[model samples]
Target: MDSPATLEHYKAGMLLSGAGDSTGFKRELNYSGPDIHEAKKQLGGLKNITVKLPDWSVSDDTDLHLATAEALATGKKGEELLQEVALHYVEGMKDMTGREPGGSTIMGASMLKPGTEGGYRIPYNPESGGCGAAMRTMFIGLSPATLEHYKAGMLLSGAGDAIGFKWEFNYSGPDIHEAVKQLGGLKNITVKLPDWSVSDDTVLHLATAEALATGKKGEELLQEVAFRYVEGMKDMTGREPGGSTIMGASMLKPGTEGGYRIPYNPRSGGCGAAMRTMCIGLRYPRPEQLSSLVAVAVETGRMTHPHPTGFLGGLASALFTAYAVQRRPITEWGLGLVKEACPAAKEFVKTAGYAVEETERDWGYFTEKWEWYLELRGLSSGTGPVVWPDPYGPAERDKAYESFSWSGWGGSSGHDAPMIALDALLGAGSNWEELMNRVAFHGGDSDSTAVIACCCWGLLYGTEGVPPGNYSNLEYRDRLENSAEELYKLSH
Candidate 1:
């Protein structure tokens, strides 16, 4: 802990270096000499002041810190304050150097700049772990609040990696298209696309990141951010967005029913909600944060998937992911958490346009079916099975497979995909390689399912748990690495 006197000295040194000056520090070493001399005079001839140094042009780091202080003094907090500070940092840097700051500062600041569409910032630079952010975080020091913010940032980064990497393969609906082909034909073949692209999933995740960066929270923030994502996607792609995003966008449009009051279909329970809720879990990883976590998860899910099953699946995924990130024995507690999240899910569905009783009845039926499938595979909510069961051996396996409307059992239903992922993980036991292969071969929603499974596995086993080959060929691998490293730093 730095003493107040030492902190004051440091502040004086920064001030003497022309930290906030837009024009004073332009002359490099010569400019610093005059500033330091003036500082000494102002300090009543303090001879020991270090500001007497000849070279002292403060970089954007100083400007960012000063801007952050100003934002804080003005009652700005969270991502919103960060955005304002970034804007001020950029302006100050440009005024001093006639250009934007270099390195990761520029990269991060550019994304927050006004007029920059959220779509363009997808696949954030993986190589942005420079000292820019760390250097300006002196004010955070050693505090629980600082750790909380760092953890939130790391979680956002991880979500970006998980969603963005999955998007690399699933963009343009290739996985779903291939699953459809296999189902239509008798071929047991799976297709892996060569090129990588992004979709509404990645766009929505980035939008949430932007919202978080600007200190937005709860339902209102998510709704506003989600609408921006829809509009940005429409502008960039010049086509109507697909998947649950279509419904989400509909809810935001002002019309006969009034904006934000539009009805969301109760049956459209796609995996979009589950895929994007991991960040929320990471941001709120404590047992105490569970209520707020569930609330935000439900709000985010209702944006696209108003169904109880839809949002419940997302909530379960987030809670499980958070537990995994905390290195809790997910295999031991995952099922129980799912059960606990169910009541909240049922309550949220009551607010939907569909008949509350019927929706609850349907939800109960679906969950029963899901639990039955788990029991048929010897994966009931009890002791862990020692051996991985063969999916092709039993009559129950066949029945479960047949129950799905698709070849890979890769139904677009949110609950179904998460169940599949959980089953695969529990079944694989300690065999990570086999788990990866099985997930890859699953013909339905392979990429999305794989993303969920991989993220969980990564959380449990860390980076070393993930095979090199899995991400070595993937785009933006560095960014994923950077995110993982930051998370590790924050957690420790």
Candidate 2:
């Protein structure tokens, strides 16, 4: 049997690999097979060729190989190891000027992040057939295997909540921007204690998050969530919660008969349900669990919202987060959720024994609203490709917000909250400032949209680009991060 590679053998292998890479780079770029043979004959032999720096430096393959080796040498394993490798890969970019790095490798490195259940893996790219990964993975084969995972969004979500809450009472539209300008922009607006506190949006979102982190399932989980909601209401004294939320929490009572629930509320089509349901996605984030996510989100949503508008908003928030965990494209998340979740939401409502006629009417309204909004982006029927770029400028976003407005508030209704959040997320891409500008510094229900948008953004990108001070002193940061970690653990 072949013996394992020793230290000396590994060193020799690495040198040999670098030398081979350098040789291949020169040969491929300079000559074809017969031409190279003629050159070899002219030079007396192939061994006569001298491969050295300046004339023949190693390519990106060898650079990445050394990066992988350096990361492994740090002795980090699993998720941390992956992150370290990604870090090294990014750091290695400075040396890649003449190396001609592969496009896929560059893209993967640029996009890679730490502390997710998805690990260091990038989304599937069908056209990424190259030897970049193979060349760099040699050191990975030499290292001992291990696993670890973790999230940073819960803290950032709270940061968004607190920051948005500051503008909730007296600011909207142009006034919100004026306030931000007065405060020297979002970057200078630090998120700290009493000055910047979370509203009821975060209180109830925490309630839902805490319940999900308990690792319970089925009816018992629902019961736990209901209990937390009731308890959460008691803490909303200065938090300025919504009327529907207060009413719903007051009505929630524990019993052995099919968990806590309330009848449909025609007037409760507000963002109350949507703001706090993203945690459901963290708990049941698998693609196969989409139905369960719908059922749970619908049930929890009805505990307060009851109407199709309210419950469906909750479903959208949760489903988007689930899609984020799966690394699905943001363009697909909105329409994708509507198509996959609407039927399940309807089935859940019917199974719970709602009036058939009323149910049909509500479902129709909910489905029609989503269709209208999705169509605005040319995602007609929830199955078409996205044909419009989401708006980023204040005027454009304001126009979009006006289109989503209902009951005089831009994102006041449950449906529009998710709509606005999704639009903001779609436009923001990896830009954190853009996300805050579009979602938080908005006209209506700023905190509601902020909570959902920030959570989904956190899941997809973590807090990589965010300023640390913005989230460092956030209230309830420990709780938020703990819940995020628990959910991340459970997700993996």
Candidate 3:
């Protein structure tokens, strides 16, 4: 290893700053997160380690301890023969996301296939909600390398959800490809958008409108537009923030017991709003609007979540992401950003001593007990009808929140959801072996968490789809390209 100096390898580039306290607004905050400096030290020792490729692993030397172990394998860096792992990534989950199977939610999984004509198709079914929109948003960072492209990306991801499939398959399904074609805004293109691609009327039209209005309103453009567009999520069925959204955060109104400066999260928090955060790059200026994302998203959280922890949960997620990419592997890094970002996220949650799991996967188990913790233990029924219940005070018998609740965590939903998302990306580990150890036991929404895991894994790999069996999904290629393009534009 070399000296202990720190090196920040960003995907594109991002600023790391401590978001200011509830006071004067500071445009650019450079916060590296707690223990981040120490994390850098661990990274220093990492260079000395050599990653051995498995005979069959997704990313060399699969983190075999946890996951079921994929058949794919990778080779040494700089080797001309390193297996193309990113390709299969998009392949495995495409069709699984359809309404019939994957249906109506990003929390569902989809399968990807390669073919002629249009390279990709929705294959599975259409899903609604900001989570699907957000998870599929990788392309957003790709095509849109500028303000203009960012708008287009947002339109496609968010607005696409307005449509409904099933029963009216032809009208709804066929239009999905058309929506992508238009929202991709790739006019006069011989490359037809192909067929079978799933999209929604809400995301399509809303994104289209945003594309048109981008830059028209100056700085606050994205904030206003994305906020407007995200409202579409309010209509998506089965979508609601879990109660853990406010379980243990500081900002819990006042007299909060057990050490709460604030309840950190509010009951209204869900993967939905954070999913909407991806499109934000298109709407807001970084470093500048970053804090606003935390602040305004909180107001939005209050809509359904009476608890502040829910708000903090979303806030922490976005902030950590905007901050943690500073250390992604540029030379030969692991797909650890998801892992790093989640724990780093606790810096915000720590305000409430919300309890950060040993790792992101542990959150899976903690989440299992989530609803049990909230309704039975956290929420007290005595005080009737709290719009936003503060989980502080004497473990209270009050209900400043019972009536105004958005929805319950239902235990089942939260448990499986995050992990499914994890599997979707599959990058939880430094290698395949590690990936398994981290994801397989993931509680609650196994399928959905896997979906997200795969998606996040795909993020580390950028536009590359998972290899062989899944890669050539033509439709996947197109959408992946489109999504990446959109994200690229927003970064600048």
Candidate 4:
């Protein structure tokens, strides 16, 4: 190789320390309503702790977090959110080079390898799909790299897959363009992703609509645009739905691909699509401009879920991030107000009293073949499939391993890494317990996650957030930082 390929990642801790000003830190708000009340009741009345929105403001121009936080704080729409994200990127992350790997077999089985080392350097895996990028690269639409360029990056993400985890939070332009075509390009197009892959039809469609609505052209200030395309499709094709989420976005589609899958249940709540929603508001103008964005997001989602549970969930996240950027506390009013705006999240609001009754619950819970009560008593994870070091074991580094499993797909590295790697790209806090921990838990994919997470957190917090350059190499980190700034400019 021409000088040992470089590694990549996001830096969570650093952003916390640097960026913007220290005065930006705000206080936590009073926990209102039954949700906090329930948590307090469950925790034996220990309610309200010092929970301030994470310190630091994204770049000034169009801080996604700030814009999103403002929109949510003041009430806004999904289209506005879209406008905010795309508009900022005209310059924000123009140089960003990691998240969109252009060519490879995706993260799983789809990737191929050249067999020229002594014989075959490694065995070929053909199972995983690059769904992680959809989540980790939460800022892609506004991160420069056009739809066409992003796909090329995605294919290359898993480029080094043959040796170890090679995927990073890079964009794949051409491939993304193709995926868009398959997933229905902007305007009145109809398409879909490969059998196992997901085309960003929903992402692009809404973004496109926002652009068309606002008459924002050339992608200079996309967030300021509208969602006419998304709105247009609402009547005919239906709103964009989450890919195999809780409601069953996978219920049915133009093809038989969705029908064949099992119940459309995503194993996560770890901010998968929520992050995407946040980016929209993040890019929107001010809080007053959020209504359309919020409406579009919720309306688009309703095609598959009339219930609005997820619609509100997405709103909560997007607006919460928006509110967060303003240094506002995550108030009961804030949480309550979200549902008021959309009134959909209330569906999951558990009004009934709750109890935690479990016998000798331990490890291997998810793998257990026990009955209802037994399994409930012992589950690898409850209500969600979490990804992390054994939370129930001797290595009790709970803080060390942030939960990256947003979609309930975790356990072994070999079978479940690509997705994990995606999470690592956006995850905050410490690194893997050890190198072995990184690879052992998720193997090749694990390090990629850790590395990528470092960069994102780094942007949010700064360089100090990282654990040395253990995961990130020189070339990659530089590329990420420059890109992050460019994206920050685009957002501004």
TM-score to true structure, per model = 0.53, 0.71, 0.33, 0.29
Predicted model with the maximum lDDT: 2
Q: Model 4: what TM-score?
A: 0.29
C-alpha lDDT score of every prediction, in listed order:
0.51, 0.80, 0.29, 0.29
Instruction: Kindly report which residue stretches of model 2 are placed more than 4 angstroms away from their true locations once superposed.
Output: 1-150, 256-259, 354-357, 381-392
lDDT of 2: 0.80
Q: Considering summed lDDT, which 10 consecutive residues are worst modelled in model 4?
A: 352-361
Q: State the lDDT of candidate 2 residue by residue for 1-492, as single tens digits.
A: 122344677789899899989977776676478887787788778688688878889999999999989988998877788888877887887789889898888888777764555546789899899888898877665531001112555676788889888877643567888888998988887888779888898899899999988998888988999999999988886789998988988888866565478766778888899999988888877778877898889888888888778878999999888777766668777677677778777777778675445656767766787778888877665445555644346656666786787766778888888898988887788899989998998777788889889988887777877988788888888888888778877766
Clashes of each: 6, 1, 159, 131
Cα error of candidate 2 at position 168, Å:
1.6
Worst 10 residues of 1 by lDDT: 185-194
Regions of model 4 farther than 4 Å from truth: 1-272, 303-307, 330-459, 467-492
Error of 1 at 2 (Å): 35
Candidate 1: pairs in clash: 79-213, 79-214, 79-215, 80-214, 80-215, 126-479
Per residue, candidate 1 scores C-alpha lDDT tens digits across 445-492 of: 544555556556555544433444334444334443444344344323
Local error of candidate 2 at 406, Å? 2.5
